[model samples]
Target: MSEFLSHSHPRVALIGECMIELQQHANGTLKQSFGGDTLNTAVYLSRLLGSAAQVDYVTALGDDSFSDAMCAIWAEEGIGLSRVQRLPGRLPGLYCIQTDAQGERRFLYWRNEAAVRECFTTPAADPILAALPEYDVLYFSGITLAVLGEVGRARLLSTLGDARDRGARVVFDNNYRPRLWRSVDQARQAYRAVMHEVDLALLTEEDEQALFDYADSEAIMSAYRDMGVSEVVIKRGAQSCLVRADNRRYEVPAHPVHNVIDTTAAGDSFSAGYLARRLRGGSPQEAAEAGHRLASLVIQHPGALIPRSVMPA
Candidate 1:
C-alpha cells in the first residue's frame, strides 16, 4: 500500500454539503433522498475502503428531521460523523432533479438558507478546522467552494494549506455550477486559491471548459502543471479520460454502459473509486479504470446512490 494508507486505517475527510434531493418523475411525483458531491464521494469511499480506511464527512447541517435522516444514512454507509455539525433553527438544502430521455439531469435548487453555508464560520467549527490537517486525505469539490461562500472558503483554504504542509494529500473535484457563484471571476478566484494545495485534481472536462474557458484537455493539464499539481485526471464523459501523473500521461477509456439512466452523481462516484483504489496502492491507470467502472454502474441507476447491494466487487 502507499505510505498514505500505511497505517491500519487511513483517515480521509471530505468537506461539502448533503441536500434533500427530490427526483421528479414523469407522473409528477417526487422521490426524496439525500445527495451531494462530496457526500456522495464519502459514502462510496467508505463502501469501497470498508475496514481499510476511515472516511469522514465535514459539513454543517440543520437540527431538523431531514438532517437526522441524512446522518442515519451516512452512519449506515460506514462513514464517520464526528465532524458533522447540527445547528439550531437551520435546515439542510433541497434540490429537485428532472432527467430527460437520455438520462441527462436538470436541477432546481433552494439552498440559500442551508445550514452548510455557515459550515466553517461557526464557533464549533474552530476545532473541526484545527483537526482537519491531521487526516491522511482531504477531499472537496468546486460546489463545496461555492456553497461555503467567502468566509468559509478562507478558513477551508487555510486548513487545506495546513493539511498539505503536514504531508496529507488534498484531492479536488471540479464540479462547477455557475448558478452558485456570483460571477465566473469569483469562482475562478476561489478555485485558484485552493488549486495550489491540491495533490490530485479530478476534473470534469466540461466543467473545466466552462469555468476556465480552457480550449481543450491539454490546456487544462498545462495550467495545473504550472500550478505544481503532480496528478491530474480529466474526466471526459463517454470518451477516454486523460490522466497525468508523475510526469506520465495516460488515456483511460470509460466503461461502456448500454442503458443510460440518471447521471446525477457520476463524477462523484468516479472520484470515490479513483481515490479508494489509489489509496490501496493502485497505479493511476488502475485507479482511473476503477473510477470508470464505478461511474458506469452509477449512471445506470436512477439516483445519486444506487442500492449498496449492487456495488462492484
Candidate 2:
C-alpha cells in the first residue's frame, strides 16, 4: 500500500531552486520561463494530483519581477507557496538553454548569487525548517543539495534526519550537474549524508555513473541499498526503467516517442508521474508505467513544460 494513501490529503514539499529560463530558439529568439529539476516535478505533481494532495515548493526567491512571475505561475498550477521565502534585494538564478538540430539541449547558468543559496540559513528560514517535518512527504534532488552551500546543506541534513524520525517520507532524485558542485568528492559526501535518510530514491543511470562511476546498474542499486534506501528506481533514457523495492526487482519498458523535439525535463516529469501514481495507491509497476507515459509526452514538446491541454489522459 502507498504510504500517502493512508492520509486524507497528503502534504508534499519539494525543496529546490527555480531559475529564470531563457530558451534560445533556432530563429535567434529567446523565450523566458521558470524551470528547475525539482520545480518541474512540483508543477507536474500538482497538475496530476490536483486537490488530491497539497503540493508545496520550499525555496527562497528574490522580491523581484521575475520571482513574482514565477510565483504567479506556480499558484496558477495550484502549488502552495506558504513555504516559499521572498528575500529582499536578492534575485533568483538565471539559465539559458541552447538546443541543437537533434533537439539536444545544453544549459548555461548564472546562479552563483541566487537568493536560494540562503535557503535554509537566514534568520527568517528558522520557522520554515521547523515546519518541514510536519509534511507527510519531502522531495528534493541533487541540485537542491548543490545550491544549499555548506552551511545550508548541514542544516538540511539535520532537518531531514528529524523529518524521517517523525515518520515523514524523504524522496530524492539524483539530478546531478557537475558544474553546480565544487568537486566530485564534495558532491559524493553530501549525497551520502542524505541517502541514509531517503525512503525513495529516483536515480538516473547516467548521473549515477558520472557521480559515483558505478560499474553498472546493479552496482548503483547495490550502493543505494547499502545506504539504507528502501526503494530505488534507475531511469535509463530511451530504455526500460528498473525499480527495486521490498526485495523485488521489476523493469518497465519506456513509452516510445518517435518525435523527440526536446528532452529537457524527461527525467523530472517521470519522477513526478511515478510519485503521483505511487502516492495515489498505485503499485510500483503501475507507477513506473505512469512515469514512462508522462515522460514520453514531455519529450515530444520543445520546452520543459508541455501545455496543460496536452496532458496525458
Candidate 3:
C-alpha cells in the first residue's frame, strides 16, 4: 500500500507535535514523559527498523529544558532531528494522562500556546517545507492538521501535493480529536482533503466512527478505498486489525494482554512496527504481526514512550 519506494530503506518524515506528558499514577503522583502521535511513530519506527530506515520527526518546540530532554531522547533513539525546530521563549504543550482501573485513559491538555502552532508558518519553515518533497515517505495525522490552523493547513497541503508529484508516498493516521476542531464538518472537510493525497491509511475504527458516524468498519474501509488509498488498516484496539495491502485484506489479531497499564501510544507504535516491517521486506501479514507484538508491549507500560531496553531485541 502507499506508493512503495523503489529503495527498501528510505528517508521518512513523521510530522506532528511532541508535548510534555504527565501521567498521573493511582497514588496521585505525576510522572513526566513526552509523546505525540507522529513522534511516537518516529521513535518506534527508528528503533524497529534500526539501520534499515531513516526516521525523522517534523515539529517545533521551545528552547526549554523539556524540549532539551525530548531532543536528547530522540538522539538516543537514532531518530534524525533536522526537521525539529526550537522557537525561543515558547514552550511545548503539556498534557496529563489519567487512567481508569480497567486501563482506559482520559487526557487533559494545556497546549494552546505550544510552539508547534507555528511549525509551518514560521519564516524558517520554508526550507523544511521545500525539503519535504525530497523524502520518500511523509506521515502525519489529523492532530497535525488541527494544530496548524487554516493557513498552515493550506501550506501543508501544497507541500504534500509537491511531494506526491515527486513520487513520495503519503501515509496518514486518522487520529481524530473533535475538541481540536472548530466543528465536525470542518474536520471532515480537512480529513477528506488530506485522504485524497494519502496512499497508505492507518485508521482506528473507533476514531472513524466518532468522526464520520460510520456504521461499521466496512464502511470506513470503503470510504478510504473510494479515496483511492491503496492500503487501509483498521485498528480495533485489543481486537484484530484489518489490513488491506497489495490488493489483499487480512484480519490480524492483537496480542492478548493480561494487564494494560496504559495505552497512550499503542496505535502509533503499531503503525511504526508495521511500516518498519513492511519496509524491511515483510508481507502485510508479517508486518501486522510485528505491529501487534510491539503495540501489546506498549500498552502494558505507563507512558507513551517506553524504555528502549524493554523493546524487542
Model 1: lowest-lDDT 10 consecutive positions: 1-10
The C-alpha lDDT values of all candidates are 0.94, 0.94, 0.90
Model 1: per-residue Cα lDDT at residue 82: 99
Q: Write the per-residue lDDT of candidate 1 for residues 1-313, one digit (tens) a residue.
A: 1232455578999999999999999999999999999999999999999999899999999899999999999999999999999999999999999999999999999999999999999999999999999999999999999999999999999999998889899999999999999999999999999999999999999999999999999999999999999899999988889999888899999998899998989999999999999998888999999999999999999999989899999
How far residue 300's Cα lies from its native spot in candidate 3, in Å, is 1.1
Superposed by TM-score, candidate 1 places the C-alpha of residue 122 at a distance from the truth, in angstroms, of 0.6
TM-score of candidate 3 relative to the true fold: 0.97
**C-alpha lDDT (0 to 100) for residue 299 of candidate 3:** 90
TM-score of each: 0.98, 0.98, 0.97
Residue-level lDDT tens digits of model 2 in 146-258:
99999998999999999988889999999999999989999999999989889999999999999999999999999998989988999999999999988889999999888
Model 3: colliding residue pairs: none
Alpha-carbon error at 68 in model 3, in Å? Answer: 1.7
